[model samples]
Target: MCVSHSVSPDFCDKVMFLLAQEHRGPLRGGGGAGRTAQEGGGAGRTAQEGGGDGCIALEAGGDGCIALEAGGDGCIALEAGGDGCIALEADGDGCIALEACGDCCIALEAGGDGCIALEAGGDGCIALEAGGDGCIALEADGDGCIALQAGGDGCIALEAGGDGCIALEAGGDGCIALETGGE
Candidate 1:
């Protein structure tokens, strides 16, 4: 087990005894909820969904989607393996989300904008808020380049990629990039 809540099953609340599964939220992502993973540390499985009453987390082999909120004010989240999302209408309200893709894309979407991320390959590319600006920014864990933000300000970039971003047009202008080694 890569990570566990307690020492033994007697006290373990969320102890993962597998290797083909993973969690991808604030617990490991940032501040989001409904964390999930596909190929981290767990036995091979397609969609083994589990959690608490308030948890809407799901997992799969192709993709994984986990919406931060929208169910209520608590922390409504969902995760899958093929897209990982809580679409606009389904995202509910006050939704915080963190998305990732093993192929070549990862995203964290919020209406007002309040999230962070850390991507791997992603074809060496990164995209912040597709609609607004970001709070804290830094992209330096892609291929070997840095990416640029859309058109706003405060968006930072380190060893990330700039496939589609405008200078000074992004958001945040934030972060001490090139220093850290992850997205």
Candidate 2:
């Protein structure tokens, strides 16, 4: 999605890269002009995203751009184009995003670390909980990332390298089903 701003008042002559892609500049592009963002003049600059409920709103400063942007009621959403549609975020902080319901929240970290915990509220859903040792984790403490459960082998008998996925944990006793992803 390359957009040129020859008519906009901003870029007089010097090329400037719009780090965040929400409304583009302080304003939205509506003049029938779009340019590839590859024209960003310089590199290694600081950028800030204005709004979004998630930890990552825009990935303009890093790799992978956004796939789609749905400014519904101002609550930035992804387009309904379905799968196979890849609107790359400027950065790749987290994957699979769901709206916060009741009190459920999912946190993600791109390079530093991943979610410290993913919890559901009230009696909503225990999608995450940090006290179990099943193949899949319902919760996680701030420990090994990219390196799954290296904290206390008592943690979850990890096979080293697995995502600490809640898959096996999601199903207990193989089929008895104590509670998917839960003990």
- RMSD, one per candidate, in order: 11.6, 17.2
Q: Give a tens-digit lDDT track for model 2, residues 1-183.
A: 222111123521211232244445342222222322222313642222323333223223232223233222222322111212212221222223222212212221111123122222221222332223332233332222111222222343222122222322222333322212322
| Candidate 2 segments whose C-alpha is farther than 4 A from its true place | 1-48, 51-59, 67-74, 77-167, 171-183
Off by over 4 Å in 1: 1-54, 63-70, 73-95, 104-106, 117-126, 130-142, 150-168, 171-183
Backbone clash count, each prediction separately: 47, 25
Candidate models: Cα lDDT each: 0.34, 0.26
What's the lDDT for candidate 2?
A: 0.26
TM-score of each: 0.37, 0.20
